[model samples]
Target: MEKPQRGIQSIEVGGRLLTTLAEVGEPMTLKDLAQQSDMPAAKAHPYLVSFGKLGLVEQDAASSRYELGPLALQLGLACLRRLNPVRLGTHAATALAEELHQTVALAVWGNAGPTIVHIEESSHPIHINMRTGTVMSLFKTATGRVFAAYLPDKVIEHYIDTASHHSFAYPKSDLRPSWKAMQKTLKEIRAHGMAQVVSEPLPGINALSAPVFDHEGHLALVITVLGPTALFDPALDGDNAGALRACCAELSHRLGYAPE
Candidate 1:
């Protein structure tokens, strides 16, 4: 006997239509959807009708524009729940820490800044006052810089504006660099796809961090490794740096980020 077919032909075609709409990230009319899906509007109408009945597509009665339905949002939320960056980074961070014998941390862009969400510590303990939920500065730490390098300009602008008013232990003069210098640093970080800081955020500590991007090429999470400055060397080609980049690239791949 032959193996069972995986999916109905009509369903596969309908899925292509749905994906085309999703890729555009906007509601589209029948003509636009048909053209984008490379099908005739007459052919596409039937698929849309089925999708509408199933609550996978919704049409605006006024304009006849079609958008993803509530069910699509429900499905997207479910997918996001499964794609939690902290959960995805757990295994990778643990393996890196064990292999390199350094503290590995996972951070995500939080309301305040790059917020630590998970950590894997090596056998050798390092003294630093940080834990899950700790938010680091946008310019002072490797994890924070990786976020600064990748996050949108508006978000970084907000951070800078907020940081100026709130006083921190670090002298304001030191924390805020000339805009020119800051841009240059961020440019270099973008070029390298990673960031490193040595004994700046905290004395005697050194860190290197690489970004993990989502399918949209947005910063999803950052993986960082830290150790005593004396023991940790933040070399781009060094063992720790190479491992961190590889681990982050793997995570990004899982998130569907394909580099151009």
Candidate 2:
């Protein structure tokens, strides 16, 4: 094995304090911060003092608690600005496709509707007509429903009003006939943290989709995984759904989303 590269030990130790504050996500007293960082209060104080001078952290005058400083905010914004959600979502989809051995797709809101932007095909072929730029149904598709559940009501209503004018394929569903029922479905999707379709959009096919959010808690994209109905479990509590949720959660974290 190659010899390990060496770095400053003090910097690494100080970094733990910063990491702890970020993870905790609030102002912390010196005692709590040191305990969480697994260091004595005396040891952590010197690092905090240095961090204060560097603008990486600051202590509240009234509460006497430490929180991230303005420089840290600038650094986080800089990183978020450099991120491309589509690029990152595609990378995540590729890994999810391999892990689940199912077709995985990434969709973003387009002028028409939720449009597929990328696809990672499985080793086993799935005979769907989906491809890049394919616009999915806001009510019928798991991918579209994920967007509908998170996106603003006005946006969804606009599409609903002009849905007939568009040439997009909307597979038949009970929700199609009733607006109130569709709202209930959307609420359920939000509650479950994902949407699922079973043999509707296409016979013998099932899909599960989850949303990825950005630093501002805005929906960044939707990731959907699909396979034959016989092989894929459409259960919201199944292993497949669990894996998809985990993948989306990790992608959301990478995009700087901290859920409240």
Candidate 3:
């Protein structure tokens, strides 16, 4: 047996793979796994087995499918408790989602881009997202835009340049807007510390997003509440904006971003 690829084989790479799995909750095909893991199928196979053995992931019996197993869930929940943004954002998103009966997400910059760290689902079947692990761009999405806005122009430019319009397998063009337009949008987000986008990224998806600053006093994460376009308002209803701001303030505080 070729010596099991030993020692830290780029913790960052493993981190990215975990992030990918978190973003895509359902079991993925080997091809999908390779693409999402950014590794050759052959390479991923061994590690997938390793992870399965450790109970970090489970290989489904029916279709030999893979989804995060119970152990992984245990670890994830443990990590969530320690993660500042998750702690703050999860409660906030959950409350808002339950109150308005809309989907809410607390997102943050992961290895590749913006990733949904926590999600609160709506009550109705007409709700937006049913599952977690959805990844979207930091350029075109409301949460992404809030994330991009806080970064430098060069950082924002990179996201615009590298962003994929449709995140899945099928590569699509014309879905992405011009970089110039994205830059202008980022400018506005920077000024306001938040952004609202309607029916743009995915049709009928309306959302409001804002950045959460950390102890370093830099934007560290984003939180967004999403609903059908029919419920969107030109402005967030009474106290909603204040609630979001308060959440950001608390999260940032926990992260060591105390104001001077």
Candidate 4:
């Protein structure tokens, strides 16, 4: 036998089609798929037929639309099984803590709100006590602002209620900015894809947070970095904010988020 090549050309071409489908995140007609894949319809159809036979792609008889099939789901689930968001985020969080020399946290959307599931402390020793399982306040902390900036309105409302009344230690008097003003601030946070808070929530503390998106384009988690205000600043376009955003974006990419 001659030297064996790594991959078949036809399979690689078909993979482009599958990736196009995934990137679109919707079913498409053969013509649309071919156009998107930059191939002729005739060429695309045969590959799709093969994919259908192998259970890699499926077609709706009623609508004549093509989509990823059960095998693709099985493969995706198998991949996701090993790539838990928190587990994946830990590497980035640890590196970020070392880079910034501050307290870094990874928070997931717990039933109560943005809950800190992991924390890496700075070697310099900060004066805060953020531990694992500690729930961050949705209205006060930088991590909570990130969730509020990205999560659905209903979920935001639920956490807002909790933070305003029961969960957060800060009373309403400490929560500055009127309701309308807070909305404007959150809008800015969403536009910037990060949040920053200085003092108020916890005196002498400053923080920055960025949201991590999953494959479904939903907010999966947030990476937050906090330190004493004397050293850390929460400016809109600060150096630390940029680093935090880069880290979150990297984690989001690992989770299969492709920005449009």
- Best-to-worst lDDT order: 2, 1, 4, 3
Off by over 4 Å in 2: 1-7, 166-176
- TM accuracy, model 1: 0.67
- Rank candidates by TM-score, best first: 2, 4, 1, 3
| Residue 49, model 4: Cα distance from true site in angstroms | 2.4
What lDDT does model 3 reach?
Answer: 0.68
Q: Candidate 2 clashing pairs?
A: none
Tens digits of per-residue lDDT, candidate 3, 100-205, equal: 6766788777655677877777774344543556666555678877876786667656655565443541233432556666777777776666688879677877
lDDT of each candidate versus the true structure: 0.85, 0.91, 0.68, 0.84
Clashing pairs in 1: none
Model 1: CA > 4 A from native:
1-81, 164-175
Question: TM-score for model 3?
Answer: 0.57
Candidate 4's residue-wise lDDT over 111-131, tens digit each?
757889998888766777678
| Candidate achieving the largest TM-score | 2
| Model 4: lowest-lDDT 10 consecutive positions | 168-177
Clashing pairs in 4: none
Q: Total backbone clashes of model 1? A: 0
Better of 1 and 4 by TM-score: 4
**Candidate 2 lDDT, tens digit per residue, 108-208?**
99877899999999987699899999988777789988998999888777777766665564533422556666789889999999999999779999999
TM-score of each: 0.67, 0.91, 0.57, 0.74
